[model samples]
Target: MFTEEPSYDVLKTENAFLRARVQELERALEACVPRESAEEQHHVPYRKIFDALPVSLGVYRRDGLSVAMNTTSLELIGGIGDEIIGKFNILEDPSSISAGFVENFQRAAALGKNVTMPPCAYETAGSTLATIDERTVWTETTYVPIKGDAGIEFLVECNIDVTERQKTQKALEEKHALLQALIDNAPMSIFANNLEDRTILVNQRCADAMRLPPEAILGKTPRDLLPEDRAEEYLREDRQVLEKGSGIEWESERVRDGKPYHILMTKFPLRETNGKVYGVCGISMDITQRRRAEADNRRLQEEIIRMQEESLRALSTPLIPIAEGVVVMPLIGSVNGTRAQQVMEALLEGVSRHRASIAILDVTGVTFVDRQVADALIRAAQAVSLLGSNVVLTGVRPEMARTLVEIGADLHGIVVHSTLQSAIQYALMY
Candidate 1:
């Protein structure tokens, strides 16, 4: 009828063209929509698992905008699904911005890789929908980038709360710092060693005394750092302390700066709370000057005592020459056996030195004479007679005469006078 109804071959060509166009449109529509693939379907179950995790997780767009968040992530940000799904921007949100989440996200997106950050404080915004209070918490966050055909598509943020752990770690660090300051600044030499004789700790003074750094001293035994003989002695002493389970104070010699030193060291066993000995601790002080002073004092005192004894001996005996060819020796104080011998020696020496023909022995100053003194006087006279001199004894008081008689001391061959004047007169005449 009208141009053969557009020919059969042309109709078939048009139909085929229409079918191909419809198929092209369907492909475009499928690409435009987020179609689920086998791989994407595998990720679906993992998404559910991630949402149930205790850690906060979120999928952020490459533009730092939140795309989807788990319940934990939503609770961490104190926001609802609608508030965060399409409207939340990490850079614009007060909580995430303060937490530095936006900067971490941008870095992961730009680098198209994972970015991890140290612990940081995350502050919550005051909102009624917030699960947590408006307080700061310590968190360690990591951002992982999701890749697509156009490069990075999204960033997955994972946050871990470490508030309690960080608090405990900070406290321990502060205490350690304080203890280290005390140990370094101590005045005395202090050290600790293990049971195997390995050095565990040493103060600054201890290291300086040993002529080594503190770090160099640790883990080294006394045998490694000290002279061989000294190390052996030190180890023995330390072992005794550990075995005794008590503290001991002893003096030992130490060499430092090319000089010898006397050290007073206090050593004790290092024990645990259960009273098991693990090692030993020691504190030492330099006592070289004090010991030297003590030795010097002893020598000085002995010298003073010797000088005083010499002075006393001189005062106890005196020799006097009263007239020509006459000599007199006077003895005073208690004449014990020792003093009697000294008197005899002095009289004989005086007679010979003066070449006296007559010798007078005086006892006038001798008070409270004993039998020993009487015997000593008689011997003096007899000895003078042997020297070819006339011996005359004087000052024979009644009490001394009684003592001489009681002791059966006979001076028959010796001349006896009542006073020193008589004895001197008689001796000069003879």
Candidate 2:
């Protein structure tokens, strides 16, 4: 019992030694364990940030298994822990949200960079549940990578429903195609030009008529297709139309390939919404056939005139004697210059032919007489008298007498009577 009395000092010494050894080991272990630096401590809060994001946020390991996800991500995937943990594959379907998505994630991890493909098509069981019809579900997806203390991590994806927008765009494209078809097939030659007088658009008819492709004529002015002189005229007219902001109709002759064409052109000043004239629009009609017809008609008219004059001259020639008796030429219809000349010629010829003692000019069938008729009658009488025959005129109306007297026609050598009966009686006396 007396020997154990020295135990307090020994116990104290042993306790001190144990304390020192424990302190040295704690320092060694502390140096080997590698404590988190300030940067790592700062990034500790990033996990909360990723989990609290509104968009579907996810952190995937390089092995294609989802390591973590936010609430929205979990909701989008239908579940978080066992649902999409490691069972999901990436290459089965390019359109599958869980399928090709892993491939994109792996690519980002490999490059240690961010990659974005144009909104890719994606499908998933979770998205399928949201779809009304099982046939189709359209979504646009995006993938991102996050770099932190855990090294580069892949984001699963966030999908946005774009079915309506895609459908609208497709419908618009279809409508545009249909409208272009109508414009191309239109009957009339529709066209448009820019302010610089360059052709911007032309339909098939216009291109065909110009003997050029629609593309070939683009950016070309009328001057390029028209002759220099004609181009100048067209430019002047177009300028006037633009200045006046009005419409004009013009007829012009165009020669193409050594052939002439008559064109009826109507031009209108093209205007903007503000009513400012920018250029001119025109429509042309080929009137070559009409012009040819008119020319032919003119030629025929001249020919008819020439023929009538020749006939009048032939009738005006004096006739030779056929018998020793009177020759009768009964005047018919309204006698004008030509007809009257014929009658005079026939009368003189008859007088010469018969060597008749008397010549009677009958006008019973004549409707009305003019100064020309009276002149022709006087000429006939004078001619007959010169031939040594007594000339008598018959069937003279009062109006005819007045007209002849007013015209001062020399009818003194001619014997005039109101009826053919009187002339015949007078001739018998001769």
- Assess each prediction's global lDDT (C-alpha) against the native: 0.83, 0.71
**Candidate 1 wrongly placed segments (more than 4 Å):** 1-188, 227-229, 253-261, 273-276, 318-333, 344-370, 380-393, 403-416, 420-430
238-354: candidate 2 lDDT, tens digit per residue: 787777778988788878789988888877888789988777777777788999999999999999999987675554443433224444445666778877777677777667667
Residues 246-307 of candidate 1: C-alpha lDDT, one tens digit per residue: 99998888676788889899999988999888999999888898999999999999999989
Q: 224 in model 2: Cα distance from truth in Å?
A: 7.5
After the best TM-score superposition of candidate 2, give how far the Cα of residue 197 lies from its true spot, in angstroms. Answer: 4.5
Cα displacement (angstroms), candidate 1, residue 120, comes to 9.9
Which ranges of candidate 2 are over 4 A from the true structure? Answer: 1-90, 94-191, 196-198, 205-212, 220-238, 272-285, 297-360, 365-375, 384-392, 397-430
Error of 1 at 239 (Å): 2.5
Q: Which candidate is the best by TM-score?
A: 1
